[model samples]
Each structure stands twice: as C-alpha cells, then as structure tokens.
Target chain A: MQYERPKSLMDAASLLAGAKGSAYALAGGTDLLVIMKNDDFDAELVVDIKSIEGLDEIRETSEAYTVGAAVSCAALGESTMLKEAWPGVVEAANLIGSTQIQGRCTVAGNLCNASPAADSVPALVAAGAKAIIVGPNGNRTIPVEEIPVAPGKTSLEKGEIVEAIQLDKRAPQSGDAYLRFIPRTEMDIAVVGVAVSLSLDDKGLVTSARVALGAVAPTVLLVEPAAEAIIGTKLDDAALERLADVCSAACQPIDDKRGTIEFRKKVSGVLARRAARIAFDRAGGK
Target chain B: MSAIAVSTTINGDEVEFLCQAEETLLDVLRERLGLTGAKEGCGTGDCGACSVMVDGRLVCACLVLGAEAEGRSIETIEGMANGDELHPLQTKFLEHAALQCGVCTPGFLVAAKALLDANPDPTEEEIRFWLAGNLCRCTGYDKIVRAVQDAAQELRGS
Candidate 1:
C-alpha cells in the first residue's frame, strides 16, 4: 500500500484520481483501518486529508457552521459552541463509538462509510446539513441525505471528497434531539435511530420540522410525512401520534439477527415519539 | 516498500522510528519501542486495550497509523507511573481489584488518566461513558468504576 499525505486539497484530489488501483481518503481511519486489517480493503493509494489545510477545521458563524471532514468526533463533543448550536448532531456523532473511537473517528468517515445505522447521518439530515464535496473538477454542495445512496455505497464520484459538512443557520425557538436504541448502553450499533428537529413560532406552534430515521432503509430516510405531521401544531398527542405513525410507515427495514422487521417498525414509532417529545421540551414549550 | 520514518514524542521523550505503511501505532509501540504495556486485545477500535493519548486526545493506538504519529505527542501506559510510585488511578485499581487477567489494565489506566487530566471530578456516569470503549471481559465494571471513583478522590486529596 502507498500512503500519500498530500498537503493541499488539489494535490489530494489529483493523487486520488490518478491512483492505479483502489484509492481511499484516510480521515480518522476508525472504519478504514479496521476493514484494511481484516484484509477486506485493497488500497494501492491513500490520500491523508488531515494534512490538507483547513480540512480538519471547524468554522462557525452566527448563520451556519461547517465542520471539516477530518475533524474528529472528540473535537465536536468538546466544542461548547457547536454543541450549543446542534446538540443532537454533536451527541449523535459522539455516540458513534467509544471515547477512544471519538478521538479518531471523523464525522465525514462515518458518512462516507455509509452505514445504514450511522448515528450522525440522521441528525445531520434532520438539521438540513449540506456536505461540501470537492473533486478533481471542482466543488459542489449536496444534502447530507443524498450523499448516502445505499447501505455501503455513496453518491460521490471518483476522486470526489467531502470537504466539510455545513449546518445552516438555525432559527430561534427550535431544538433538535437524537436517540438510538441499541442492545447495550454504548459501543453498539443502532438497531433504530431517530432524529427530530423542530421550530416553533411565537405562540409555540410547530412551524418547520424535520424527522429522519436510520437503520430502517438502504440509506437514512428523511420522512416528509413525519415532518408534515408535526408542523402547524403544538405537537399535541394527536400530532405526535401522527408523527410516530408516519415515521413508522416510512421504514423499509430488513429482518436481521439484531432486530426483526416488526420490532424495528415498532421501535421506529416509539423512538420517533420519544425523540419528538424531547425536541419539543428542549425548544422551551409554552 | 520503503519504511516511513516517524518522529514522535512519547512519555516526554522524543523518539524516532521507521515503520511499514500498514503498521499501526500499537504495532510500533509494542514491537519497536518495546512499550508492551498497551496490550492488543482487539486490533479494532472496539476494544480499548491499545488506548493511548495523542496530543492530549485519548485514542486507540490500533486505529492510528504508525506513520501518522509523526510530530505527535503520544502518551502510553509506560508514562502512567512516576519512578517507584504508581499513579493514583493505578494504585486505586490495584486496591479495588480492577483487573483479572491484567491484559486490559494498562489500557484502562491510560484512558482513566486522560479522563482525569481533563476532568478531575467526573461523575460515575461520566466515567462509565468515557471508559465504555475499554472492555474487561474477565471482570465486570463495578470494581473498575469504584477504583476510578476512589482514585479521583485520592487525587483530589480528599
């Protein structure tokens, strides 16, 4: 294997594009290293993006925040500003692995790995985050949900790189929360994950909302009906019931040893309701 | 394949080594530097048996590339002791019987040191959550938690 730590994004892209065999970008390398150790990876060229300028930075403004692809999950958890702005996203990303993994795992790597049960993808999607994808040609912005097209595949073209993930300026009277049901308290993959982001008007009426689910489909699902269910209401029992039902109705899960189809469906609804309730309370319900 | 030359600071000492492209930090520490304290219970990040601190951040050495350790400050279990005196966490772990086979002890000590360095007084929940990556297969976590709590108290001079 050839490991090339390019000092610039342009150089990195060219190196990746010009590889003769399997080329991979090394971020935090939590997942990539594991796969490589198991002999499942055949990489001839690897571009270490951490050497690139600003690729490991977290840029924050009042309007939005952009986390560089190589930024570790530990950095995300430590940032009071980032956590204050997007608690759900930070918590979700922090919950990916153990404390040690957080020190090395990148949120970008998590998205690129494209696991169906990714802890951070749902929260990123629910927050309307966009991934800034750069490639040999140039750069383009794509929604977080669109990046993961399948369970283990991404929509990124050859030589394309995720520069940073940007969360748009959040509106006031809004809060987001993420919850995943695993068999253990930690260090376990999500059997079912849900993220709910909602905003309330002056009267505490739900105005804008987004609900996303993970591990229930090929990719994380941004359930429109689930979002639609809670909008234009105060998230009362009826609205929340509809929200749960719609969220559950959108699942396309497969029966696996970890969870049956029926169990996942039920948990999706239950988790959706619980997550929405938390979001509602966090938004300072009147 | 040409070996990668890496310059790293471990335990306050500047160290240099050459490692292969596929070599992990844990491999170099154990094989080259003879820092055998950081065990390799599971090469994957799932087990924290190879946990270390890179630039003050707690990380599993197995997940870090050996070449990537260049110009980084690393702290392994070898740095956890002070001459003849064990660190408070180590002292408490021995007292609390936090180990069975002793394979996971070094990793736990390193991880706990990182935690206490950041937050001297962590809650029980915080300690459990922070150490969730370190697994003790032969023993349950009750003693480990108590050891950490007692160590924190000891370090606090309480």
Candidate 2:
C-alpha cells in the first residue's frame, strides 16, 4: 500500500487524480479502518488529507456557516455560534459515538460514509445544509438531502471531496432539535433518529417547519408532509400527533439486530414528536 | 511501496523514523520506536485500547497513519512518569487498586490524563462519558472509576 500526504487541497486533488487502483481519501479513518479490517475494502493507495491546511476551519459568514471537512465533532460542539444558531447540528455531532470518537470523527466523514443510520444526516437536512463538493472540474454545492443516493453510497465522483458544510442563516425565531433512539447509551448506532426545525411568528405560531428522519430508509429522508402538518399551527398535541403520523408513514425500515421494522416505524414517530416538541419550545412557543 | 520519513515529538523528546507508508501510528509506536504502552486491543476504532494524546487531543492511534504524525506531539502511557516518580494518576491507581489483569491499564491511564488535562475537575458523569471508549473486562470498572476520581482530587489538591 502507498500513502500520500497532501499539504494543500490542490496537492490532494492532484494526488487523488493521479492515483491508480482502489484509492480512498482518508478523513478521520474512524470508518475506513473498520471497513478494511472487515475485509470489505481493497485499496492500493490511501491519501491522507489531514496535513492539508485551511481544511480544518469552522467559520461563519453573513450568508452561511462553513464547517470544513476536517473539522472534528468536538470542534463543532465547542463552536458557540453554531450551538446558538443551529443547536441541532451541534447535538447531532455530539451524538456520533462518544467523546473519544467525537474527538476525531468529522462531519464530512459521517456524510461520506453514507450510512442510513448516521446521526448527523437528519440534523443537517433539517437545517437546510449544503455540501460544498470540490473536484478537478470545480466546486459545486449540493443540498445535504441529495448528497447520499443510497445506503453506503454517495453522489461524489472520483477525486471529489467534501470541502465544507454550509448551513444558511436561519430566521430570528427559528430553532432546531435532534433526537435518536439507540439500544445502548453510548457508542451505539442510532436505531431511529429525527430532526425538526421550526420558524415561529411573533405570536408563537409556527410559520415554517422542516422534518428529517434517519435509520428508517435507504437514505436520510425529508418528510415534507410531517413538516407541513405542524406549520401554520400552534404545535398543540393534535398538531404533534398528525406530524408523528406523517413521520411514521414516511419510514421504510428493515428488521435488523438493532430493531424491528415495526419498532423503528413506531419509534420514528415518537422521536419526531419529541424533536418537534423541543424545537417548538426553543422557537419560543408554549 | 516507499518508506516515509517522519520527525515527531514523543514523550517530550524529538524522534525520527523511516516507516512504511501503510503503517498506522500504533504500529510505528510498537514496532519501530519500541513504545508498546499503547496496546492494540482492536485494529479498528471500536475499542479504545490504542488511545493516545496527539497534539493535545485524545485519538485512537490505530486509526491514524504514521505519516500523519510528521510534525506533531504525542504522549503515551510511558510518558506519564518523571524520573522514578509516577504521575499522580498512576500513584492513585496503585493505591486504589484500579487494575487486575492490567491489559487495559495503559489506555486508561492515557485517557485519564487527557480528561484531566482538559478539565481539572470533572464530575462522575463526565468521567464516565469521557472514558466510555476504553473498555475493561476486568474489575468491573468500579475501582477504576473510583481511582480516576481520587486521582483528579489528588491532582487538584482538594
């Protein structure tokens, strides 16, 4: 095996473009090493991008908050602006594995891994996050919902890497929350996860909402009907139940050792209701 | 496959090596540098037996490549003592009987050092959460948790 450590993004791009045989971009290697050990990977070249400068930045601008691909989950949890503006993103990042796992796991790796049960996908989708993809052709922005085509698959072409995650600045009275159900307390993958973001009017009426679910489908799912069910309402128990029904209906779960299809479907609704309730409370609604 | 030359600071001393490109940090530490304090309980990141402090952050040495440590600082369990005097955590672990078979001691020591370095005073819940990655099949973790708590107080002098 050959390892290439690129000092800059351009250097990484050139190295990736020139490499032959099964080469992969190493972000944090939290998932890569596992895949390799399981005999599921066949790579002749491994490109290490950690030495590249300017790719670990977490910056906020007037338009969006840009989190570089190499930025660790610990860094995301520590960002006050990110926590204040989009707490759901922070919470999702915090829930990845454990403190030790979060120390090295990056958001880009989580998305690139493309697991249906990824904890951060639903939150990113709920916050209207966009992925800045860079390749030899140029850079292009794609919505988070469109980045993953299926479980363990992405839309990224060869030599392309995620540059940063860009989340639009939300409204003043908007808030987001993420909740996940896992068998164990820590270091366990999510069985069901839900993220909800709501924008409220001055009178505490929900103006707009976005609901996303994970671990219940081939890819992270955006249940638009679930969002619509809560919008234009005061988020009472009746509104929450209707939203839960929509979220449950949107799921296509499989029966695995972690959970049964029926259990995942039922818990999807439960998590959606819990997440929506938290989002509503954070949006300054009763 | 070509060898990669890396110069790094390990245990407060500068070290140079010519390592394989595919070698992990854990492999380099054990094979080349003869620092076997960080054990390879699992080649993957699921187990934290290979935990070490790299650039002041606790990371699994197994998940990081040797070439990635070209210009970084690392601290393993071997670095936890000073000229015949053990670190406070080491002392407390001995006093509190924190180990039994002792296969996972080094990883726990390094992880505890990281936790104390970041937060001088951590609550019980914080300790539990921080050390969740390091698994100990022996001792049931009751004594280990008590030892870490005792070590934190001893380090804090409170």
Candidate 3:
C-alpha cells in the first residue's frame, strides 16, 4: 500500500487518476480505513487530501457558507457562523458519529461514502446545499441530494473530488431542524431521518419549506410533495398531517434487522411531523 | 514494504519514527514508541479504546494512519501524568472508583480530559454526550461520570 499526502488539488487528482491500481482518497478516514482493514483488502494508493491547503477551512460570506470537503464534523459543528446560519445542518453533521469519531469524520466523506442513513445528507438537502465538484472537467456545483444515486455509491465520476459544500444564506424568519429515529439513544445509524427547513411569513404561515427523508429509500429523498403540503399553510395540525402522509408515501425502504419496512414508513412521517414543528418553532412561530 | 519517516510531538516531546504506510497511529504509539497506554479493544472505530488527543482533538488513533501524524501533536494516556504526579483527572478517577475491569479507563480518562479542556463546567448531558464515544462494559459509567464532574470542579477551583 502507498500512502501519499498531496499538497495540491491538482496533484491529488493526478495521483488518483494515474494510480496503477485501486486508489482511495483519505478524507477523515473514519470509514475508508475500516474498509481497508477488512479481510482481503488492498488499495494501491491512499491519497491524503486533508493536508491540501484550504481544504480544512469553513468560510462564511454574505451570500453563503463554504465548508471545505475535508473539514472535520466536530469542527464544522463547532463553527459559530455555520451553527447560527444553518443550525439544523450543523447538528445533523455532528450526529454522524460520537465525539471521538466526529473528531475524524468529514461531511464530504459522509456524503461520498454514500450511506443511505447519512444524517447530514437529509439536512443538507433540506437546506439546499451544493457541493463544489472539481476534476478534469473543472468546477461545477451539484445539489447534495443528487450526489447519491444508490447505497455505497455516488454519481461522482472517476478522478472527481468534492472540494467544498455551500449552504446559501437564508432570508429572515427561516429555521431548519433534523431528527432521526434509532433504536438506541446515540451512536446508532438512523432507521429513519427527517430534516425540515422552513421560512415563515409575518402572519406565521410557511412561505417556503423543504423536507428530506433518509434510510427509507436507496438515497435521501427530497419529498417535494411533502414540502408543497406545508408551504402554503400556517403549519397547523391539518397541514402537518398532510405533510406526514406524503412523506411516508415517498418511502422505498427494505426490511432489515434494525427496522422493518412498515416501521420505517411510520417513523418517517412521525419524524417529519416532529422536525417540522421544531423548525417552525425555531422560525419564531407563536 | 517501505517505511515512512515522520516527525511529531508526542506528549510535548519532539519525536521521530519510521512506520509502515498502513500502520495506525495506535500501533506506532503502542509498538514503535513504547507508549502502550492506549489499548486496542476494537481495531475499528466502534470502540474508543484507542482514543487519543491529536492536535488537541479527540480521535480514535486506530482510524488515523501513522503517516497522517507527521508534524502533529499527539497525547495518549501516558501523557496524563506530570512526571511522577498524576493529573487531577487521573486522581479523581481513582478517588471515585471509576474503573472495575480497567480496560477502558485510559480512554475514558483521555476523553474526559478533552471535554474538561474544552468546557470546564459541562453539564451532565454534555459529559454523557462527549464520552459516548468511549464505551465501558464495566462500572456502568456512574462512577466515571462522578469522577469527571469532580475533576472538573477541582480544576475550576484551582
């Protein structure tokens, strides 16, 4: 095995594109290292990109907050600007692992690892976050929800890397929240995760809303119908019920030991309702 | 197999070592540097038995490659002592009877130290959340929690 820490993005891409055999980019290594340690595992090149300049920064501008792809989950959660701007997004990122693991886990790595139960993906999607993809094709922005097409897979082509994730600035009276259902209280994968971001008008009606679901499908699902159900309402119980119905209807889950298909479907709606309520309260609802 | 030469600060001492590409920092600390305080309960990150302070952040040393430790500062359980004296956290753990099997002690102590360093007066909820990564099969964590709270109070007092 060859481990090389490339100082530049171009050099990292070149090393990955030119490697003789399988190559894995090291972004925190909370997951990749475990995969490497598995029996019969052998990767010819391991490119450490955290050493690259500017890959560990969290910069907040007037327009948006740019989180470097290699930024640790703990650091991202502790970022004051990000926490204030996108509290739900930051909290979800922090939920990926425990304190020890969060210290070494990255949001980009979590997305690229492509776990259907990725806690951060649903929140990022609800926040309309964009990933800055760079490669031989140059830089392009892709929605966080569109990155994952299947479990353990991503839509990113070979030699491509996500340099950063961008969450746009919110208008006044906006709030977002993410909730996940796990059998255990902490340190467990989400059986069902829901993230809701909404902006309330002066009259306390939802002007805009986005609802994203996780672990009930091949990838995190942005339920537009669910969002539509709440967008024009005061987020009353009636609208919340309608939102839950659509959110549950959007599931495409499989049976597993952690949770059955029916259980996940039920929890999906329950989580959506609760998250939306929290988000509404945070948006200054009476 | 080629060895990677790395220079790092371990416990405030400048140290140099040659390690394999795949060698985890846990392995280097335990074998190469003879700092065997960090245990390997689970090679995977599931267990925080190998927890250490890397650049002032708590992480599972097993998840980090030794090559990645180049030019970084590392703190293990061995670093919890000041020469022949014990750090307050270490003393409180003993005073509170926080250990039974003693395998996960080092990890708990290290993780608790990290929490106190960041937030001197953390609530019970904060303490539980911070040490969730460090799993203990024995003691049920009650004594451990008391130890951390007592240690925090002692630090705040002095």
**Candidate with better TM-score, 1 vs 2:** 1
Best by DockQ: 1
Model 1 C-alpha lDDT per residue in residues A37-149, reported as the tens digit of each score: 87666789877889788977899887789999989999988888888878889999999999999998888889999999999999999999999999999999999898888
DockQ, all models? 0.89, 0.69, 0.81
lDDT per residue for candidate 2 within A1-286, as digits (tens), equals 7888788777777677777787788887788767766655677888878777877889888888999998889888889999999999899988998666787889988999999999999999999899998888888999988889998889988788888899899898899999999987788899999999999999899999999999999999999999899999998889989988999999999999899999999999999999999998887887
Error of 2 at A203 (Å): 1.0
Task: Report how far off residue A203 is in candidate 1 (Å).
Answer: 1.0
Query: Distance (Å) between predicted and true CA of B76, model 2?
Result: 0.6
**Model 2: how far is B96 from its true place, Å?**
1.7
Candidate 2 off by > 4 Å:
none
Q: What does the lDDT come to for candidate 2?
A: 0.88
- Which pairs clash inside model 1? none
Looking at model 3, the pairs that clash are: none
Which candidate would rank higher by DockQ, 2 or 3? 3
lDDT (Cα, tens digit) per residue for candidate 2, span B109-132: 999998998898999999988888
> On a 0 to 100 scale, what is the lDDT of residue A240 in model 2?
86
Estimate how well candidate 3 is docked, as a DockQ score.
Answer: 0.81
lDDT by residue (B68-109, candidate 3, tens digit) is 999899999998899999999999999999999999999999
Ranking by lDDT: 3, 1, 2
